[model samples]
Target: MTVQTWTFVIVGLTFALYILIAIWAKAASTKDFYVAGGGVSPLANGMATAADWMSAASFISMAGLISFMGYDGAVYLMGWTGGYVLLALLLAPYLRKFGKFTVPDFIGDRYYSNIARTVAVICAIIVSFTYVAGQMRGVGVVFARFLEVPVETGVYIGMIMVLFYATLGGMKGITYTQVAQYCILIFAFMVPAFFISFQLTGNMLPQLGFGGKVADGTYLLDKLDGLHRELGFAAYTEGSKSMIDVFAITLALMVGTAGLPHVIVRFFTVKKVSDARKSAGWALLFIAILYTTAPAIATFARTNLIQTVSEQPYASVPEWFSNWEETGLIVFEDKNDDGVIQYVGNQEKNELTIDRDIMVLANPEIANLPGWIIALVAAGGLAAALSTAAGLLLVISASISHDLIKKQIKPDISEKGELLWARIGSVLAVVVAGYFGINPPGFVAAVVALAFGLAAASFFPAIILGIFDKRMNKEGAVAGMVVGILLMLFYMMKFKLGLFGGGTKEEWWFGISPEGFGSIAMLINFIISFGISRFYPAPPEDVQEMVESIRYPRGAGAATHH
Candidate 1:
């Protein structure tokens, strides 16, 4: 069968499976809608969390960034995964034992302040919206290519599919559906990885193959580094980022990972604090399967891409080259009016430019793999994009329905009424997110990176301090979040978006990029929070006890809701 036929059959089969799971697991109450009845097993919760964590950026764009960023990309690999350790150790158990449906719920109850809760809700919505834009855009890209539709049409279709399941199942349906999605995404990711690993290095395992010898008896990393020099690129095994920059970037990502509301809410879906811990471990393990293999995929794709495209005549270039070029993902100028393609490593000077986001999705085509494998990739990319989008949209809906309407606007609203508003909120969020997907303000990678930075600046300090510091007052939490978010926004607007009349790296504070400014902003938040709290009277007696009680590892029972 042709690639299109395979894509249709495989994608259709996977979508059918997700819809079936959602139907079977439809939510019947607010509890079911919010936390999947809070009875999910550790293993199941882990799988769902993995699916939730690995967005389109993780599945489609990461390997591509690593392919080009070389060792500098370790910031992403380490910081993202490292944040999970912080979550499992620092926040997950405490939040689970607190036993609420959402992150803002914990903030409201712990700090004993409606204002603090409102701040958290604002931060959650902003962060989720920024992140969901990438997932929606990713859905559009895959559909545009595989389903042969306009990007706007693809995003609308994705919104429809997500709206169907998310509004109906809430967390209940999304949890089970995500379990299925994790299976499809991981299998799809690993298959091509294994195929390419075996073909390139005679090792079936991508993790081991990345460091092992290839056809010429040279180690893959060594060969990759060597080829990078010959091609005017930074060495694959060495990075140019300074030690301070790397440290700052990595820490920001770790804290941001621990702080994202969508991922944090997964802990509430489980049975106990122990389950939260175990589920985090399981989530990381599942995530590691793909994380460890990404560098290998990057190396393989980078090497294959250079070997196939560089110095080849335009007319003699491969079919995959022309295909991507037609999509404008790949472009050439024939700078000298020569027939040859001058594809350089530092792409700015080269006649050919290739979009890094296409690396994973186009890998199979570049290697001339079978149609089935290519089709599987399309399905996998969609699953990754959709699963994460569903989770983010849930957070958005829950914020408006549970936090805003029920808590702030109408305290006496019925649970059923709140659920209806939640569904309406989901539809609205999906529509706004789909519009951004069709017309992104920036590249998917850059947009999502800003989301992480925002989360790190705004939420990590507030949530962590609220739980760990007994004396931290509502005044301090509110002040810290506002300051943190403002700093990040200022830096991003100044550097990335070219607002405030624009700026450059030379003008950057301490030479740290906007992406790495979160670490600085977070530290400022911590300092300001503590400084302000010291001037005020201590937290109320009960609030101090609430903070102290959370320190213990025992007694995993749920907290009493107000």
Candidate 2:
């Protein structure tokens, strides 16, 4: 069969599997829609969570970022995964034991203040929406390349598919479909990594191959580092970022991962607190399958790309070069009119635009791999983006319909009416996200970082304090959230948009980039909240007892009190 034929067959089979799973696991009640009826097996929940958490950023952008950033990208790898340890150990089980439908629901009731809940809902909506927009853009890019559709058309197709399954099965359907997606995406990711690893280093294991000697009898990493330095670039294994910036970015990503609502909600699907813990361990294991392979792919792709393009005449480059160049992903400039593509990195002499997002998507092409592998990657990218987009849309709709519309605006709405409104909210959100994907205001990865910063600064402190500290009052939680969010906004505007004034990172108030500002904002939040709570009144005695009950696993089955 032709490669395009195989592409059609593979994508068709995957979609069919997703639809079957959705039909088999369709939700029957509001509870099932919200939390998969709270009966999912830990292993299945773990797989679903892995798929939901590993979005387009992980599948497409992460390896690309690493390929370009070299050692500095390790922060993303270590920080994102390390945060899960915090979530599993400190947050997930307690939140599951609390037996709440949403993160905001737990915070509001725990602190005994509707205002606190409203702030949390707003923060959740902002984080989820910003994150989902990038996922939609990933879907568009994948479809535009492999499926031969317009980017906007690709987003519409993704939106429709998500609506069909998400509205039909809710979390129940999403969980099963995500399990299938995780399988497809992981297989697609690893197959290319293995092939490329063996081709480059004659080693079967990608992780070891990354550090092993190349076919030319030189250590791969050492060769890469030498070439980078010779070309006026930073070494592949070392970075130039300040230590404080590195520490802050790592901390921000760690805390942000713990604060994400979709990831936290996965714990609610498991049956018990112990199961939640087990599921988190399993989720990390599944995630590691991708996380560890990504760096190897980055190394292999970078080496292959540089070797292929370094001396090739610009006009003689392959069709793939022209194809990607048309999309503005890879551009070339024939400085000195030599008509040869100079791939060297000269800090002062070279001016070329290479979008890091192209690293993974163009890897197979750069390596001259079979067309089937390239097509499979396109499907995998779409799967990653769509799964994450669906999860984020669910969170956004729940914030509006469950928290704002039902709880605050109209408490007497019927169950059916509430669900209808939720579906409406989902559709509206998808439309807005689709528009932004086509007309993004910034880079995909950078936009996602802003979302993480916002979530970390606003929700992480509130949720952590609400669960673990009995002395925390509504006043402290509200004040902390306000202070954290405002501080983060100030940092982002100063660096990201230059709204505060004409300034750059070199002139940052404390030499802190916006990307690393979340950790400081989170610290400020913790200090302010804890300090004020000490001076003011504590949570009521009953609330304190409730907090104690949530820490234990035995009483989780008790009927939830409104």
lDDT of 1 by residue, 1-562 (tens): 9888999999999999989988999989999999999899999999999999999999998898899898988789998889888988898888877778888888888778899899999999989998999999888878877777777788998999999999999999999999999999999999999999998999999988998998999998898888788878778898889898889888888998889999999999987777888999999999999999999999899988988888898888887777677566677898778899877666565897777788999898888999999999999999999999999999999999999999999999998999999999999999889888988867677688788889999899888888888889988888999899999989999998899989988898998988889999999998898899888888899888878777764555654343
**Candidate 2 lDDT by residue in tens digits, 202-269:** 99889999989997799999888887777677788998788888888889989998999988989988
Q: Candidate 1: minimum summed lDDT over ten consecutive residues — where?
A: 553-562
Q: Looking at candidate 2, what is the lDDT of residue 332?
A: 83
Give per-model TM-scores: 0.97, 0.96
**Native-to-model Cα distance after best TM-score fit, residue 153 in candidate 2, in Å:** 3.1
> After superposition, which runs of candidate 1 have C-alpha atoms over 4 Å from their true positions?
346-349, 557-562
lDDT for position 534 in model 1: 85
Say which candidate scores most in lDDT.
1
Determine which window of 10 residues in candidate 2 has minimal summed lDDT: 553-562
